[model samples]
Target: MFKNVLSENIWGRVVSEKEPVFEEINKIVESNSKLISKLNNEYHDHDSTIKLLSEITGQKVDDSVGVNLPLYSDFGKHLSIGKSVFINSNVMFTDLGGITLEDHVLIGPRVNLLSVNHPTNPEQRRGLIVSPITIKKNAWIGAAATVLPGVTIGENAIVGANAVVTKDVPANTVVTGSPAKVVKTI
Candidate 1:
């Protein structure tokens, strides 16, 4: 499967015996919003903002500006977004591996779509798990919520606010709680 192959190829090179630093790959990977004050300017259009971000992260971003607010992702190099997706403020997407979001998705505030995680084995703690986060078409990830690695959020699913999703959310259902459960099926 491409997922496994992709993960193994990319994340295998991410971690080291010491902690991995973004600066180590700064030239290879893009992102310096903290260093460049202008990139953070609100005046930059969403498309332009994302474009600059792509240059910084070395990722490919398709169809930015689904909403007026600026979208931020470390995976601008690895993320491939779809059309008409309205994402709200303060979304932190760390796509060190890859993050693919399908069309017509709605994202709320402070939503974290992270793809990189460390292994449980302390002996092999240097190893990395780069699982791409896939939000299928028409999915809604709620506010201040966290979607863990390798979990596929199904099409048209509605994840409630502040939910911590540790598993795959089936399509057309509503999920909530710390380790989100199926609250309702829509």
Candidate 2:
């Protein structure tokens, strides 16, 4: 099903407020829920966790890629994670739009990578706005960070703990605080 729906423009096409894309999102989420359930269940064997993660992402993950338990995502099919990525516990990906984590990226605990937003208009607030999130090679997102829709974490950039990222982060910089601002260049 994921292979069938995966197209270059399919994600972009699903953004219309009037469309039934939300229903599609629910279907995808429902299909993937079993996998995530197994992942989080104590009864399941731990050895096959990586295989489950690969299935959820719809991509082959490197042997070096490591993710802690209890990872969460609403839509996992649209996620693209690269080699040697390390994602800690309690990471949530609202991947209705898409999420790309490039090689060697490190995601800290309790981080939220949100790819969906709502319109400000009272009548339209329930409507979904979708956007892709990209974390470039070697980017590090610290604990409890919330990365909003359409943002990019540049290569080797660091987002400090508890920061709220709302824009593109420049390469080789460190950002902290709400609506994260560049604090230093490393």
Candidate 3:
């Protein structure tokens, strides 16, 4: 079903909602949403949750990774969680383009890692723009932070609580507030 519609290089691609390809994408999203709902509601233990996450990603999730319940992802297949990563409860990942959480990353509660967005132009608002989001190794994202599409959180960086990141964060820095600005360097 996802022949030309989805691929490894889907980043920066635009797909209109009117297109047939979008229907195929929506179908996958719907099916994955059901599994995500089950993961949120039924699986409370660590092993069971990781097992379901592995099923969602179509790969074996490492035993070293830890994730709390109520995790959400619109396109679960595009998410990559590395070893020693700890994800808190109620985190959301819109990983259509792809979202990579590198090893030893720490994600606080209610964080949103968005890798897909709609066009800014009103005429093209119905279309979706694919962009990848990468959280480098050992990075820490505070509670309720929202990382926008195409942004990369650098290694060992810290994102403050409720920060809205719209651009790439430099390594070993601390960023806070909307459109997140660097406040300190570690």
Candidate 4:
């Protein structure tokens, strides 16, 4: 269903909303949204939730993963969750550009992992910029943090609560504040 525009090379490209490809993408997003609603509202048990999530992503989600619902994703097909990953409630993943959470990753409540943005130029603001976001193994993203497009949180790193991460975080470090900076290295 998503063959027209779901390519690895889609990263960093700006796609106009008026394009036919955008319509195709929108359809997929809408369909996924319905499934997400079921995940948030209908399914309460862990097994049932994971089964629905697997259907949403078009992949087999591992049973080792745990997600507290009310989880949201704009484009579900691009999200990849590894074994033993735990995602808290109220988390939003705008994963159109792709998002991968490696094994042992912990996502706290209300966190936003956004891999899609718009052009800064007002005239081209309707055009979408696609980028990937990766959370490496053992990384813990604290409550209410926002990880922006193209950012990677390295293995064993900790993102402090409410931080806005705009750049890559190195491994074994603790980062805090807006445009999150490494405050300590482990």
Best by lDDT: 4
The residue pairs found clashing in candidate 1 are 30-56, 30-57, 31-56, 58-77, 59-76, 59-77, 60-77
Candidate 4 residues lying further than 4 Å off, grouped into runs, are 1-9
lDDT of 2 by residue, 73-120 (tens): 888888888888899999999887789999999999999999888877
Best by TM-score: 4
Off by over 4 Å in 2: 1-18, 43-47
lDDT, each prediction: 0.71, 0.84, 0.87, 0.89
- The parts of candidate 3 lying over 4 Å away from their true place are 1-9
TM-score-superior candidate, 2 or 4:
4
lDDT of 1 by residue, 114-178 (tens): 88888787886766667778899999999889998878999999999999999999999999999
Candidate 1 local Cα displacement, residue 78, angstroms: 1.0
Between prediction 1 and prediction 3, the one with superior TM-score is 3
Q: What ranking of all candidate models by TM-score puts the best one first?
A: 4, 3, 2, 1
CA-only RMSD, every prediction: 4.1, 2.8, 2.8, 2.4
